[model samples]
Target: MNWYVVYTKPKWEKKVAEQLKKSGIECYCPLITVMRQWSDRKKKVEVPLFNSFVFVQLPDSDRNLVFQSVGVVRYLFWLGKPAIVRDEEIKIIKKGLDGTDSCEITIVPFQIGDKIALDSGPFSTQTAIVQEVNNTHYVLVLESLGCVLKMKYK
Candidate 1:
């Protein structure tokens, strides 16, 4: 058995994980608590660490079983094959989140003017150039899509 990445509908990570678990499929949807502000009030909410993604552990033959659950789109693919998450990597993620009072994970550093391909979302497979970078967000120019995308980070 191997751990595979599952792409899901936006904001459905937790729901899909719950469904998978009820069906006896072991899954992981890493979540973190963050303060979100509304016009009237501010509240702390738990959100998935990786948006629209959940991890499932199952044998290769059972991959299709995940689709029976609503909100699951498909398995994430890499290099023309389903992406596999190593067991050690999964353990590290669990340990990092479990062992910390407050944990911060930094993605690879992106510099201004660096060109990169989006791995997920509506912009998946599109190449974008980094227009601006800061501690809270990134301004990306998606030439193919003819739009500027601002991505926020914690």
Candidate 2:
């Protein structure tokens, strides 16, 4: 069986994943706990890491089984075929979210005015220029996109 990406209705990633599981289909919807502030109060909620997206592992012949779940729009495509998610990639996501304190991450030092390329997130593959650097955060300017991004260290 191969893992394929599924597009779900907005704000429905978790529901779709639950439905797929009930049908005996293996699925993964990575979630993160985020702090949300409202006018009245602030709360922490678990939200899908990738909005409107979920991953399902199923054989090619059983691909249509996913349609039985509501909110599932369609399989994500790449190069005119269904996008495949490698098992190792899935393991990495799981390990990162497990919060076991065993994962080690090293941040490479960047100097101001240095050119860099984003490897992940919504701006993946886009080149940016380092504009400012400080102890807590850094600013990047995406000239092609005409936007400035500020990333904070955790």
* Alpha-carbon RMSD, each predicted model: 10.2, 7.9
lDDT of 1: 0.95
User: Over all chains combined, what TM-score does candidate 1 have?
Assistant: 0.65
Q: Model 2, stretches more than 4 Å misplaced?
A: 102-154
TM-score of 2: 0.68
lDDT of 1 by residue, 75-129 (tens): 9999999999999999989887785666668887899999999999888999999
Q: What local distance difference test score does each model get?
A: 0.95, 0.96
Q: Provide TM-scores for the models.
A: 0.65, 0.68
lDDT of 2 by residue, 5-87 (tens): 99999999999999999999999999999999999999999999999999999999999999999999999999999999999
In candidate 2, the residue pairs with backbone N, CA or C atoms under 3 Å apart (3 or more residues apart, or in different chains) clash, namely none
Quote the positional error of residue 46 for candidate 2 in Å.
0.2
**lDDT for position 147 in model 1:** 96
